[model samples]
Target chain A: MRPIRAKLTQLMIFGVLLSMLAGCSYLNPKPLKPWDRDVLARPEMQLDADSMEDLMDTKIYFSKEASRGGANIGGGGCGCN
Target chain B: MQLKQTGRLGPALAAATCTLLSGQGAQAAETEQVDVTSLQYREVDRVNVDEEVIALKRKGKDEKRFSLKLYHDTITGASPNGAYFPSDTYTSPSGSSYSSTLAPITDERYAVSADWEREDSRRQKTQYGLAYSIELDYDSLGANWSRSRDSQNRMRTYSYGYGFNYDVIHAEGGNPVGLAPATDTTRSNQDNKLLFDFLGGVSQVLNRQGVFQLNYGLSLSNGYLSDPYKFISIDNDAVVDNLLYEKRPDTRLGHSLYARVIYNIDDNVLKGSYRYYIDDWGILSHTLDMRYRYKLNNDFYLQPHFRHYSQRAADFYSIVFYDAPAASTYEYASADYRLGNLDSLTLGLQAGTRIGKRTDLSLRYEILRQTDRLGEFPSLNASILQLSFRYTAK
Candidate 1:
């Protein structure tokens, strides 16, 4: 039963991802031009502008909690866990 | 005189023009940056940590970048040893009385990592990284590789990555036998574990004011999953009868789905993210985070952040065993509160400003609280303070 549920969840996740990709054609009819990217280029708009702070937060949370990973990949290991 | 002027002047003019153009290109594409950060974390009547980090990055004109980071931290104080108190005192089977209390500990850690990335003219980027960390009784080495490509219009990005880690644990004193009594003398000096991680993601630019990303991550770990220093108490008629070292399954598999959105409204930026995590150990969790960067001016901003997390207990997690199982049965059990049902919340604020033409500084503070759903374990409160400085070379 657990294996079946796990498989179903995996399928659902992939299904959602596929639908999102397919819907992109209709959702993004007018893509922004290079000249219109001024706001997007700002430091505040970057996904990981403050890498150090993000690293610290990830480490701290990982030590105190059981659930980890999602934001990025591969940050070695620690005994604190 | 005219011949000499044409011969020398023409070549010199062309050469100077070429040098000027190349210099301008180099200036536009090359960058060097250094960042320093310090953090202090304190848990109410529990652990305290002091950490410092330094990072250096260099980007070349050929779209290649390299970065190195150094980390050091010191941890000290006492933490709950996974024993629960059902009464003021409990008599052991030998007619001895004892009281449960926190366990004192101190440790220091150092870690370093280096990463390199290269991007081609076709908008395909590849990255490689290596990391190592060491402590008094633990050591870890890791490596990772990733690649990403952008769509023709640069409106979408697809990425995938893989990582591997090898770790060795040499517990202080010795590694305790799993599920054995705390007083048992049998022990091993070392144990090891391995981890593998895989990630896939997509990022989309939704118009000029917003962006969205979705990611999926899978992780697998095997061997030595138990904490040697933690133990569980067996309750017998409201008295602590026995204490056994914690035990856990040797393997774990986890999956996570994460989504994030960033939008710019006027001059302010708003960021939000959600994550759903599940594991084979019967633990399921959800996390939600939100941040709003209110721009007071171009040089200064105040950001408020909030995060909430909730999780269900693992299958083998228990506060105390009413009926102790035989050690020969090889049953899996642990009293670690981190594996128990709980909810946590963090509230934080950050203030950042430009200190000089090529430098910036930021300060952040956060408060976190964790509540145990079973109420058998004590609640936890912690505070975090961090300061950072960044300098860019012109």
Candidate 2:
């Protein structure tokens, strides 16, 4: 992959160009509807999906790698790799 | 979960009728209503959050006079350190030494939070909050404070936190598995670290259903960052079975970015979010979360969610690692999953009915299943049930 700066620059340029070059658009923002929010508004549909699932996944992920940061802000006693 | 997840489709399709029956466009709101919503969650000793919020407005005004929320939670659960199937049987890239299976552990935790917010009709809003948490056994307490503002075209939020932590195994105790010289007792053993965190974000409402937010967070921590139970394994077959235990680097820096989007629908809403994370240890991660909510009617709904996560192992990661495997296997651990892949799915059902004109209750159930990227790794699944009752005397 290119450097981080390159990726950021590309995104900025894309956003600027997209804003300046919009012709007739069919994807305009629409009004909010109850039916549409039916799925998105549910608590079960929150970012983590299920806490139990996230907990299990977090344990698995933490044990398997050096990277750890997402839901919470701490680590605990562990002898595993 | 898959079957129930599939069953949810039936209601979603049935809810399609709502779009045709209801009028289009946002509905008008009534003036002067006091609305309060709250949830108290408990997870034994693993995780718990009690969040109660109340919003009050005058009889006929565009401004929200006041809002308050109080949260308290206690978390307790058995977290697995690492799992190993026999040496030949387990072939993870990182490698694990002990061909063993250990029972899970229950770590205790408690947390509390309170917040107040206000917004004048001018559309400007301000919010302030305070939070605290303590993890028993390991003996750690976390304190935090936050503030934010919001309006029409632009929104901004800023927050800061401080924490003090201590580990008994690190400072006072001798090497639990006394075997050799301890050059690395400093980072892994007993610890006192102060934590500082800061977050700043900007948000823009691109229309009704579309919103974009960007955030940057910096965290500085001292003390130990290693897992007392997490050990590394070395390849010397003899000592491999009896892995050594070691600590990880004490301090590190972390930075990340987050973005989310929601699309409005007549009866079905679509939402997606992504987060990118990186730290000093050369580990990078990306997470994508998507959910679709389907409304069956005014009293019913079904939702499905999917998630994908990936990350590389830490620099000192390994399956069969002996702390400082290269120098002297001081710690015992197999980096078997130190850097594993994760994929999950969730399906839920929500049904609500009113006991009277002013009291409403809802029942919800969700099933989640997770699998590791390494085809050989184990898979775990869970089921949860939620019951909520609300009473309003407007």
Candidate 3:
């Protein structure tokens, strides 16, 4: 029963991802021209503008919790846990 | 007249905007940056940590960049030893009995990482990184490589990466054999493990006001997965009768899916992300995080952040075993509270302002609380404070 549920959950996640990908084209029929990207070019719009903060948070949580990953990879493991 | 040259000015303006949007203008010059960050973490009556990190980055002409980071931290505290509460005498399998109590621990860790990246004319970027960390009893070395490609319109990006880590652990005193009597210490003091991680991700610009990202990660680890210092007690009518060292399966496989969305409205930004994680050890988790940046003025802003995380227990997690299962029969078990069902939440606020044309400074504070679902372990509370400074030279 657990295996089945796990598989279903994986499928659901993949389904959501695929649907979101498909919706992307529908949401923006035409990609914004270069002149129209002023808002997107803002410093706050960068995905990892707070890289240092995210790094600290990830390390703290990884040491205290059982679940990890999904932000970025390759930081390495520690014995703090 | 200047006003009559509108036709020529229009094309020139379009070209300049294109250069900026494509990131070509920023790479036209070389720049160096330095960042320093300090963090303090405290858990109520438990562990406390002070950490500092410094990073140096240089972006050269031709879209090449190099970065180096140095990290140092000190941890001191008392941690649960996985025994039942009330400190009762427990008999060992070898006909000896002893009482158990929490132990105080102190340690310091130092780590360093370096990374290099280069982007080509085709809008493809490749990155390579190496990292090493050392503690009093543990050491780790890791390396990774990743590549990302952007669509011609510069509105979409696809990325993939692979990472490898090797770790060595040397427990203080001596490592206890799994499921052996707590008094018996005949096991090897050193053990090692290896980890491999793979990730694939995509980022899309939904519109001028929003962007979205999705990532999937898989991790595989093997060898010596159990904590060497923890043990579980056998309960005889809720009183401790015997103690045995904890044991766990030597291999683990984990999967995670994450999605994030960022939107801007009137110069204020809102960001939210969700993550789902599952592992072969019967642990499942969900995480939700949100942050909103409110622009107070052109140079100062305040942001509030919230994160919630919940996880199911591992299959073999138990607080106390009524009857201790034999090693041959059970194969794996642990009493670590981290492997138990639990929920955690974090609330934080951050304020930042530009100190000068080339300097930025930010401060943040957060509080976190964790609750055990089975009500066996005590609730954990912690607070975090961080300050960051950055300077850029062009």
Candidate 4:
């Protein structure tokens, strides 16, 4: 029952985001300039894209687990977590 | 005591996890004009008893690249037996037994990939590359291409990618379990092997408060997907023929979804991620991870990360011997943890800073422990310490 709820919560949030993405437009942000690089250049601000710290945690998490790389695990095995 | 201890780790863990995931109590760095690149090298010596591995990556600038990886899952060597633990022994905590033997491995991986990228502008970029690897008689060659477009000040982005891997598997070894003699070099039979992955996703700044990204991927594989080298234990019974072993599923179609969200408060950053996966091979998995990164000062910061992951083993998973006649010809061990309901708790710390005027370095230590969490469970513990250094020409 708990897992079912968690799964449902995931689906709901994901669904809402999908709809917004589809209907998105540049004006979502107020009066923008043509050459604005603030949003695009904010590397520290990236959501899914991993930063150095994120990658390190990911590698450790990945190394320690029995599962495949999740997205890709074609590489060799390492005893290191 | 055992039940009380395990139960205690639950809610406190969940609350802490939620706090981290929701991205609170952390500060975000104010941007400064600076360029950064990072590199890592790891040589694991646990060999056969473990698989040895080495990797290097450099990302930043206008181009990003990384390389090399090896997985000797079916590694040949002697194991503590006490570690990977065979089935049964739940009658009591100390009921299990162990022995040492010169064992052979069934799973192996040797792969490498190099990719290059080019930016058409701040809003558009393209990437393409090729990679190849071989395990046992199985070899794979593949290529991928991706395109990303930005909007809303790059606060939001969309990307799509597709790739294909053609694999070739050949049977080897005289041992039915797929182990070769200390001196046998015979290369045996061949079978069709192939896998495919397709991905699409979007990333967005949810608010001044945080950012979120989601991806949906499809994978199709036709060929040998079984673990010829893995084994399962039957219910507490050390029986005849040591319980027959089966191969992994042949054709598996799978889908994966994952997301990452980050929140900032002045000098602290909170990051979170969740992943959901399902495959036609009768496997489903879920993962949740979170971290709090705080800048202690200009040249240093302290970041502590915690993660929780859980998965349901493939339908064929077994705790041990099943009613033989009911098992499928392609049966695999319920003990094949790679296919079981697994939950992992990770605790980590990352600390580092800029050296002189043009050098940067950081150190990281992460610890992870896995639990079967099935009706009965087994544990495999692992840890890592990473030191990374980067310098750009002054």
Candidate 5:
């Protein structure tokens, strides 16, 4: 019973998030200007600008615990095995 | 006089030699960069790991690029045995016993991987990669490919990525049973596990200050998915011994939906992400991670990050083996705390600075705490520290 409820809740949240992502343009439809990209182009502004760091962080977390793949591609293996 | 000049130049020559040996003086074409990172991770009184990684990336004509990575890490100390008993020690059926804390273990891992990517003039990009990692008893080989396309106006981007991993697990010496009787010395066979991950995402440039992406992924793992070293304790009258090997469904299907947005406001960049994950093993998890990078001038930045994670236990997870006489007869059970209900919080800070025209350096520290432990296990706290440097040309 609890598992079912949890799955349902997760599904609902996923649907809501998907819808929100789809409807974002409706809320703010302004197109970015060329000059606005100056800040956006900064290395720190990109979510995965440091791909190596992000991958290592994910790998560490994956080995130390369970649950996987929240970010990019999934890797493999267990350290404790 | 020449000898005196040579002596005077010794310090300069030594400095030059040191710089060259550090790989900082290597010359590259306008389209290459090298990144080096070192990480130290410690789980208070549990495990310690030291890792070193070096990556080289080069760009070619027409936006084509290739990258290679060399990684190695040494891990030492004890890992949880998944056995719990009120007594100080609990013995398993294989004549092996462990304390309430953890089991002693050590392993070394190494991996080498390469990636190639290219983007055409039409804004269509493709990336492919292969990686292999080997440890003492386990080996994994993985391949991944992704393709993305930008909309006509380049305002929206769509991507699809597929990854597959093949792994072999061979226990050192021989595999032992979870709940073997005193007389049983059955050696288990090698186990194989295969995993496939599929991901699709749509990323949109929401104004110049922000970009948002929503990704949905599915992961399917088949074959021997349970930890061979984990055990379940059956404290029932029907079982003479309390230790039993854990058994899990051979197949697991997991789904994850993740959303992320990065917005740059003034000198600060704000990043936020949320993930909802569910699996057939009756585990559901939610993760929220956020970071803020505040630039203090044009050359340095400080980033503070916060992450929260929560998950429910697997259906067969239990601290103690308390099933019916017939069911307790080793159908399926696990005492691994990783599969139990838990919540964790991570707080981190990173500081980085640009040096010279093409060199960058950064240091990061994070502390993590896992609360709401399952069973009688103590809470977990860990810390990680990392330092990284990058040299870019062009």
Candidate 6:
């Protein structure tokens, strides 16, 4: 348990450091080209490719698991779990 | 409620279609999008849920959109009665077997929600929403608001949201009396619970083919947080059976941080995410999920997903409270497996393709395996299958 906690702490710190580096990278400008944006324009490229599917998956996970996160908002509660 | 919502959708769709067609001569402005989905969820020798959801969104000319959703669920199955493994025979209050005999329970749920969004400017958007859900013994009403902003170059984005949920919980036979040396209590009035959630995040495009997002979220809940129907076995050593009602703290605070990355290479897209969650109740969890989507062609794709999750038990979780005071075992305690230590893994595959210009179809199948701490119970095996269709009225 201690090792896992230590690893997670290190990972979190690394993630924060990486985020800082990325923030500095913003100074340089390299906009995506129209051709590059073609794939981005596709529905599949969107963060939530299928909103309804994502929502249903969230519900399933919530019911089965003890943890929930990385989604928009929480709605309803049930004893079904 | 289902019939009314279904009826309303027909007129709403017709009106939107009429509006779009009427303006076709001017410019083809897409004004509406509709999504309908159905899901079937099943667990081995356990519960099953069939759900249907319909969502409608209308985009106005002034950078504003209105969205509505109708959801219905039918649940049927036998759930654990919180007792230990059966040696002879045990029965529940509903006259069903509390152990391996398996008596089924049936219930239904309905939910409705509406939201409004306005793009305040080219780089900013704001949304507000309200929702309500109802079941036989529970009712919930909630509201939420969110805002997002994009950087000038579109390389970075930030978002924040807050939501509140008010729930009224009614035990079928009223609240249980004592926690230890369990005693019978009279039926009590409805109890309530409140939840508040706050979340903020940043989405960054690491490069042309890669993007990632990180988010921090907090949830605070208060009020009657115990499950009314759950019971804890007090004396496993004795042949005579004794079940004590469960009790939990009135307030809980939870925090979680998550990161996700999506990268595209050639004809494949890889998605990965990790989430770490902790709560005041001494439960900690880590989840890792990964997926790879392969494009078969312009109109078709296949994706394979894998997820691994592990969690520690809550501070007060216990399986059997032996020889406790007749009144209660402790201040906060539960036998619910969900609060106990466990690990689970999921493997799944999804195939989808465009049926035509306006319709698309997708199918998915997954298998999950979960193992608990005590190893007294068999590893739970669950399988899920989903079929979905999306249609656009052009």
Candidate with the greatest TM-score versus the true structure: 1
User: What is candidate 6's local distance difference test score?
Assistant: 0.74
| Candidate 5: residue B123 lDDT (0-100) | 79
Full ranking by DockQ: 1, 3, 5, 6, 4, 2
State iRMS for model 5.
2.3
lDDT of 4 by residue, B137-238 (tens): 566687878788987465667888877777665545422332221233443366556767787887776556566666777778786554433454433334
TM-score of chain B of each: 0.89, 0.65, 0.88, 0.70, 0.87, 0.87
Model 1 error, position B240 (Å): 1.8
Interface RMSD of each: 1.3, 7.4, 1.5, 5.8, 2.3, 2.8
**Best to worst by lDDT, what's the order?**
1, 3, 5, 6, 4, 2
**Which regions of candidate 1 are displaced past 4 Å?**
A1-8, A11-29, B1-29, B88-100, B324-330
**Which pairs clash in model 1?**
none
Q: What lDDT score goes with residue B88 in model 6?
A: 35
What lDDT does candidate 4 reach at residue B71? 20
lDDT of 6 by residue, B1-394 (tens): 1233334345655565465445542334456666777777778888887887777666766767777777778889876656564443544333323232234577788888888888999999999999898888888899999999988877778899999989988767675643643456655678889989998888877766777788888889898888776667666455326767778788888878888888888958888888888777767899998889899998999999898999998877765556645434377777777778889899999999987787888888889888775554446788877777777764
Model 2 spans with C-alpha error above 4 angstroms: A1-81, B1-79, B83-98, B118-124, B143-145, B150-190, B238-241, B322-370, B375-377, B384-394
Q: What is the lDDT of residue B173 in candidate 3?
A: 80
Which candidate number maximizes DockQ?
1
lDDT of 2 by residue, B1-394 (tens): 0112213223533343233123231332233223333333333322233333222222213332222222222233444444343556545454532343443543333333333344533444554444443444344444444344543323222223332233333323432332222234534344455556555554444454444444555566565554555444444434544444544556767665656665556746677767677665545677776667677776556656566666755555554443234635333223435444545555556565656666555555555555556544545555545554444433
Which pairs of residues clash in candidate 3, taking residues 3 or more apart in a chain or in different chains? none
- In candidate 5 chain B, where is summed lDDT lowest over 10 consecutive residues? B1-10
Sort by TM-score, top down from the best: 1, 3, 5, 6, 4, 2
Per-candidate local distance difference test:
0.83, 0.44, 0.82, 0.52, 0.74, 0.74
Give the clashing pairs for model 6: B179-B328, B180-B326, B180-B327, B180-B328, B181-B326, B181-B327
TM-score of each: 0.89, 0.61, 0.88, 0.68, 0.86, 0.85
Give the Å error, residue A59, model 1.
Answer: 0.6
